[model samples]
Target: MNSFPVTKFYDSGKVHTTDTYYELLQLIDTKNIAFEVPKMGQKLPFDSVLGVQVLNVDSKASDNNDASIVLKAKYGKVSFLLTGDADVAIENTMLPKYDLKSTYLKAGHHGSNTSSSSNFINEVYPMGTVLSYGKDNSYGHPHKEVVSRLTTVKSKIYSTAVSGDVTVTTNGQAHSVSAKAWTPPTTTPTPPSAGTTGKLQVVKKDLSTEIVSIQNVGTTDVAMAGWKLVSVQGNQSFTFPTYTLKAGANVHVTSGPNAKSGGNYLKWTTANIWLNSGDPAKLYDSKGALIHEVK
Candidate 1:
C-alpha cells in the first residue's frame, strides 16, 4: 500500500527543508524499492521501534491540524520534527511537549528565520540537534540566528551539509550519535514566539477489538460515548450499551474483540463520521485511557 510521509512530518511540529515527497521518490529510485505514495491524510505502516509503536510514514494533514510528524522510538526520546518551512509561530507552539534536555531534534526548514523560536529552544533542550542541508546551496542554510539560539541553550549541533548523512542511534535507554562531514558551529538565531499549544500525542493504541482508543484534538471537548465500533468485515456496527467520555478524555473500551488473527477488522464511529479506524486511527486522541481486552 502506498503511504504519505509528509502528514507525519507536519503533525510533529517542524518545517520541511526539502520536498519530502520528491525525496522519498528519489530514495525509492536509488534503492530500487517498490513503494507507493498515497494522497494526503493517509497513515503509514506501524511497527515496534525500540519497544514502542511507530508509524514512520503516514498522511494525516488537514485544515484543523498542522504539518508535522512525531516519532517516539524509545531510544531516549528522539523527535524528528519537520515543520515544512513554517515560521516562528509554529515552533513556539510545539517545543514544550517533549524533554528538551534529553531529546534530539532535527533543525526546522533548512535553518530558516521563520522557524527556531527562543521559547522552542528552551523546551527542546536537545542533547544535539542536526541541520540537514547542501554545501553552499542557495537557501543560505544554517541561518546565523538559528545557530545563535542553539548556542544560547548550549545544544550540541551537527549539520548534514557538512556531516553528510547525519545518523542518531538510540536503544530506548541511551543514545550513540555519529555523522559524516558534521562540524559544530558557534552561532545562534533570533528567538520567535512560543506556539499556541506545546505538544500532543496524536496516535494511540490498545487490545480491545471493538474500540481501540479515543482521540479528541479540537479546542472543544468532544464526547466519546456516542461513538460505536464498525467491523471491517460486512461493515457491521456494535453499539456501546453505556460509554461516555469528554474531549481530551482517553477512554478504553473493554467491549471489543482482539485483532490477533487476520480477517477481523473494526473502527470507531460517531454518527456517520468515523473516529478511530481505517487511516484516521493513527491520529487517535484517546485522552489517556488504556484500551485493551481481558482474558
Candidate 2:
C-alpha cells in the first residue's frame, strides 16, 4: 500500500459524520496513518505543491454543519474557496480572520439560505460561484435570497443541477469556465507546473500610473504576505496583506490620488508615492528581507 500525506484534522474528538465512526476508525487503523490537528490559521505543509490556507475549523462548533472545514487554495492565477457546509455563524467568525477574496467559490451548504451570507459573499468577491445541488430536490437548495446575494456581487453562477459537470481552466494570466453533461469520460481530461521555484521579481514600474508590478516568474506560487514594495526616492512603502501570487501571475501595487484595488491590483496608498520623473522600487519579503529591486 502506498503511504499518503499526513492527515490534518481540526479535532479528532469533534469529527462528526453521517457514516459510522467505527468504519472510519477501522480504515485509519488499517492504514496506520499519521495525522495532525492544525490550528485555525495554519497553512498546510503542502505549500510546496500548491498554496493552501485553512481559513476555518471550529472544535466548538454548535453542529455538524458548523464544524465543516473551510479552505482556500490557489494554483497559478485561480483561487478556490471550498466551504464544506459551513453555515452563517461559521462565516461570521471567518470574516475578520482572512482575505476571503477568490477567483472561484464552491458555495457552502449547497447555496442554502443557511450560508453564503451577504457579508461573506462581499468578502470573497468570487469571480465565479458553483452551486452543487440536485435537480428539484425535496429541500430547495440555492435559496432565492442566496441567488440574489450572489447576483448582487455579480459572480457568474454555475449549478450541478442544470449542468452535469462544470470545468474551469486557467493559465497564470487568464481563465475560463464551462459546463457540460458528464459522459463516461471517454475523452475529456483535466490540467501548471514547469522552472524556478520561489523567485519573485519586480517586473515593471510606471511612474505616471504609480504602478509597480510584482510577478512570480517561478513555476510555484509564492506566499507574499507582509511583503512590501518601497519607493526608493520617496522613502514610502506599501506592505502586502495576506495574498499568494500564483506562478507566472502578477499583482500591481498602485499608489496615487486615486489608487485602488480591483482584480489583480492592490492599492498601495491614496497619496502619490512615486515621482513623475522616475523612482526605484524595492520588494521585501515577510521577514523584511529584500527580494527584488527595480529601477
Candidate 3:
C-alpha cells in the first residue's frame, strides 16, 4: 500500500487515528516509502513526471478545504486542475498565488457553491468541468447554481452523478471526457431564485472564520425579528435582531470574540460552532416554523 511517497500537509495529531493512516505509517520503516508534510508554497518534487505539479496545499486555514491539494498536470499544451474539494476560501487564497487557468477542472467540493465560486470559475476558465459525486446524493451534489456557473463559461460539464465511472484522456495538446453511461441532459434544470421567502438561502459559510450569509430574495421586505439561524451540528443559535431584510438583500453572521451587530451583519460570538463538513444550517421563523435548511 505504501508503494509511493506520501505527502500530508496537516499535523498528525489533528487527524483522528484511522486504521489506514496507521497502517501506512507502519510501512514507512519496513518498506522505506518516503513520507513528507509539504509546505504551502513548496513545489512537489515531481519534475521528472512531465507537467504534473502540486500547485498549493494551504493547511494553515482551519477548514477541511485547506487539506485539499490543488494539482495541475499538462500533456502537450493542455492542462487540468484537479481540485480535491477545496472550498471558496481556499480557492480565493490560491487565486492570487497560482496560475489557475486550465483546460479542464474537476469542480471543487463536488460542485458545491462553497467551492466553485463565480470568481474562481471565471479565473480558471476551464473548457470542461468534471463533477465528482454520487447519484442522488442527500447533500444535493453538483448544486444547480454551480452547474449554472460553469455553463456560463461555455464549458462542457460531465458529472459522475449521471455519468458513472467517468474517464478523461489527455495528451499534452488535447483532452476528452468519456463514460459509457454519460449523456448530456436533454434540458438543463434551472436553479432556485434567491428572492424566495421562507427559503432563507445559505449564500456563504466560512467554517475557518465562522462566517455565514443568508439572503432574503423575496420581492417584499421581510422582517427578520425573532428569526433564528441554527448550526445543526453544535446546536448554536443566532436570534435575528429587530431588522427587516429588504428584498434582494443578505445578512452576514460571524462567530468569535469580535461578534458585533450592525448594518447587514450579525455576530454569533462563539467558537467552533460550525462544522467543516456534513453539517446543516437550519433556519426557523419566530413562530418556530422551519423555513429553510442547507448542508
Off by over 4 Å in 2: 1-13, 17-19, 47-49, 180-295
- lDDT of all predictions: 0.45, 0.74, 0.70
Write the residue-wise lDDT of candidate 1 on 58-169 in tens digits. 3443311234333333333455443444445545544443333336667666676556777777776676787776676423567678888888887778887776777777
lDDT of 2 by residue, 12-121 (tens): 24544323445656666677765465667778767575788878776765455666778888888789999988888889998887888899999998878878999999
* Model 1 accuracy (lDDT, Cα): 0.45
Clashes of 3: 8
**Over all chains combined, what TM-score does candidate 3 have?**
0.58
RMSD of each: 19.3, 22.8, 11.2
Q: Model 1 reaches what TM-score against the true structure? A: 0.42
lDDT of 1 at 37: 35
Q: Please write out the lDDT profile of model 3 over residues 40-109, one tens digit for every residue.
A: 5555556564576666665444544557677887667788898886777778888998889998899987
- Candidate order by lDDT, decreasing, is 2, 3, 1
Which is superior by lDDT, 1 or 2? 2
Please list the residue runs of candidate 1 whose C-alpha ends up more than 4 Å from where it truly belongs after superposition.
Answer: 1-45, 49-66, 70-73, 76-84, 95-102, 180-295
Residue 258, candidate 1: C-alpha displacement in angstroms: 54
